[model samples]
Every structure is written in structure tokens, then in C-alpha cells.
Target: MLVALIALITTVLYFVGGALLMQRLKLTAAGEPPGSRGLPRLFTLWGAAIVLHAFVLYAFLFGENADSLGVFTVVSLTAWVIAAFLFAWSFRHPIHVLGIVLLPFAGVTVALDMALSGVGPATPMDPSLRAHTLLALIAFSLFTIAAIQAAVLAIQTHMLQNHRPGGLIRALPPLSLMDTLLFHIIGWGFIFLTAALATGLFVLEDIFAQHLLQKVVFALIAWVMFAVLLFGRFQFGWRGRKAAHWTLAGFVWLFIAYIGSRMILARLLGV
Candidate 1:
């Protein structure tokens, strides 16, 4: 009952934050300068939501009978990390607009974890494996943010090209700034992904025996895709649509490598 209450409160806070952000964006679109009080309130609400969400995670992950890392739990953790990063980034960068999508998603994740009761297999992990998992989750969360940013960039580019650069485009940072932010996020994500893969190697005894071959292959493919994209950006000056497409494509493979493989193994193959 206590866990449920915490989850409920966290969910409400998340939705409230998202709604407030959306309204702020709308106000910006309508040429209204943001109220000085609004930003502080939004941050407070989001920070409170993140704290309560952490409590919910603790209850689910460390409470009695917590033997496995459930799918919903993993997703909730990812959402939590993403929200935290966004909150920190907002202090220096105008990326709080992302909360218009992410905060509500975090709310839904918390609710789902509560509703499903963390349903998953009982796979235990040692410290090394736990570290690997943590790195992977962080990398995935960063990629998730980059993917959203890329989508927004794609839309922003399209609107500008079509001479309809009003509304969301106005709400967003400038095109060059958005592009720079996306690559910055991708660069950090790529570094974490590299570390995750490296740590994964130490934790796995046999890839084939452990049924992690598919996961590894796809992850490496994603790594290569991002590597090429980064090289192209620095070496050949790739940006705009090309950069957005590559970001999305790389995230797809990374998604398949992590979430897709887990779902298949847990649900389809019962492995």
C-alpha cells in the first residue's frame, strides 16, 4: 500500500510537470515571455517527482522477494536517469522542453511498474554484472534522449525548409544549437556504450553459452553506426537530416540489442 501510494504520487508529479512544460511551450509559441516564477515551480515539481520515483524504485528493487530485474523496473530506472539528466542539463541549457514528453513517460513507467508488480524472470547478478547493467542502462537512457532530440530536430528542419517555422520551432532552441546538443548527447552516450560493452566482456564467460550473441552483435553494430556518424560529423561536417537519420538508426539497433533481446528472451523463448 505504501509503495502504491508513492508510485501514485510520483506519477501525478510527473504528469503535472509535463503538463506545465507543455503549457510553457505553448505560451512561448504564443509570444509570451516565461514568468520568472514558472521555471522554479517546474523544477521543484520535477525534482520532487524524481525523489519519489526513486523511492518507488527502491521499494520495487530492494524490497522483500526482489530477486529479478523486471522489465518495468528497468524501464522505470531508465526513465528516472533520463529525468535526472534532463533536470541537471536544464540548469545550463534550454532543454527543459524535453520534459513535455519525458516526464509523462516517466509517470507512465512508474505506474506500469506498480500495476505489473515487476513481473520478470529471477536472474541474479554479481557486482561486476551489476556495474555492466548500470552502464548499459545509462548509455541507453542517453541514446533515448538523443533519439527524441533528433526527432525534434528532424521536425524543426522540415518545418524550416517548408517555411512553416512557427509554433514548436519557436519553442525550441535555434537549429544550430539543437544540432550541437544532439551530437553532444550522442558523444557522451557513445562513450558510455563503449564502457558498457567492455564491462560486458568481463562479466560474460561465454557469449554463445549465455545466449547473449544476438545482444552483443547488435550492440556492436550500434556502436559502429554511432562511430561512423561521429566520424562523419567531425571529419565531413555531417549535420541536419543526415545526422538525425543516423541518430535514429543507431538508437534502433541499440534498442534491439538491449530491450528487444530481453523481451524476446524473457517472453518468447522463456530463456
Candidate 2:
């Protein structure tokens, strides 16, 4: 019941905040709006969901059941803080479009958190573990933003190659901006992924033969992909469609790494 209520509220926030966030990002005929209206109110719903989930965190932590699933809550909260900060920072620049992508992503995460935050040994945070976890998660999150940028870049590059523009393409940030953001995100994601893996190896009892091992495999594959793309970008000067394609590929590996783990853990094991 608690999970249902949280999901329902977050779902509403997604719709309401997502729709209004779009309007708040309304571009003018001249250019992007004012360049500084600040974050849209709809985004507040996302924060509210994050804050609300803290109750769940506390409950599971202190509740008689002491569900191990509290780890999901921690993960969800970690993502929320990172996304919120990223969105807030990006908004100060020309990355308002990111809000549209991130808010919906976060909404889905909230729902997932609710579903999963019901099992596990309830590993409470220790200083070193928390530090490693936060760094890894923030790095992983950058890949998410990179994924969104990749999608936007692909669409823009397509329109450019075909010599068509306007509509959603117009709504996109400049292609160069998108590309720059992609590389930037990939760079951060790679670095963070490295840290996350390192931390996981230290924190876990067994690194291999578990779901975490699978996640590490996929993540390493993603890191390699990102590394190759980065090399290509700098050395071979891969740009336009090739860059977009590589970005998408790398982000796909990243998606499988974490989301796949969540799916197996939550759906199959009921954790």
C-alpha cells in the first residue's frame, strides 16, 4: 500500500511536472527563453518524491521487518540527488531540454524504487562505502544524461544530413552543443564507472558469480565503448552520425549494466 501510494504520487508528479517543465522551457522565435527563468515548478514534484521516499528509507531502516530492500531506496535517493543537481546545474546553461529527459527518467526510477525498496539486508551506509557509492552513482548518472543527449544528437544529425529542420529539431540544442555534452557525459560516466567498479569490488563479499558480476561485465563493455568513442572522437575525429551512433551504443551498455541488474534482482528474485 505504501509503495502504491508513492508510485501514484510520483506518477502524477511525472505527468504534471513533465508537462509544465516543457512549457517552462518554451523557446521563443528569437532564441531560448530569457536564458534564465530558473527551474520550472513542475520539477519540484520530483524533489518531493525524493524527499517523500526518505520516509520509506527510515521505515525500512527502523521498522520491525527491517527489509533488506532498503538498498533500493538508497539507490533511488542517490540517483535523485545526482539528477536533481545535474538538472539544476544544466538549467543555468542552455541544457533546459535535459530537464524534459531527466524528470521522466527520475519518475520511472521513483516507481522502481518503491517496487524494490522492500527486500535486502538493509546495508547501512559506512563512510567509505557511501563515498564510493555516491561517486559511482553520479558517474553512472552522467551516462544517463549522455544517453538523452545521444538521442537528441541522432535526431539533429539526421535532420541536418537530410537538410530538414524545424519542429522538434528546432527544439533541440545546437548540434555542437549536444555533441560536446555527449563527450562530456561519457567522460564523466567512464571515470565514475571506474570508481564504482573499484568500490563494488571492495564492498562486496564475492565480486563474481553474482548479479553484481554481470553488471560489472556490462559496465566494462560500456567503458570500453566509451573509450573507443573518445579515442575516435579525438584521434579519428568521429563526428556527426558516427558519434551519435557510438554514443547510443555506449549508453545501451550502461543501461544494461544497471537497469538489467535491477530487473533480475527485483523481478526474478523479488529483491
Top candidate by TM-score: 1
lDDT of prediction 2:
0.68
Clashing residue pairs, backbone N/CA/C < 3 A, model 2: 68-119, 68-120, 68-121, 69-119, 69-120
Local accuracy of candidate 2 as per-residue lDDT tens digits, 1-271: 7756866686567656666657654554235653445454544665675566555445554566543335566567655765666656554556656667676666766776667655653444676667776776687677777777777788888888899774556656788877877787778778888888777777776655344777778888988888899999999878878888898888788777766676667567764
- lDDT tens per residue, model 1, 1-271: 9989999999999999999998888887798857554999999999999999999998877888465677778889999999999999989988888888999999999999899864765456678888998999999999999999999999999999999967688778899999999999999999999999999889999888787899999999999999999999999999999999999999999999988998788888777
lDDT of 1: 0.91
Decoy 1 TM-score against native: 0.96
Alpha-carbon TM-score of each model against the true structure: 0.96, 0.77
Output the lDDT of residue 190, model 1: 97
- Give the residue spans of candidate 2 off by over 4 A: 1-11, 24-75, 119-128, 209-211, 269-271
How many clashes would you count in candidate 1?
Answer: 0
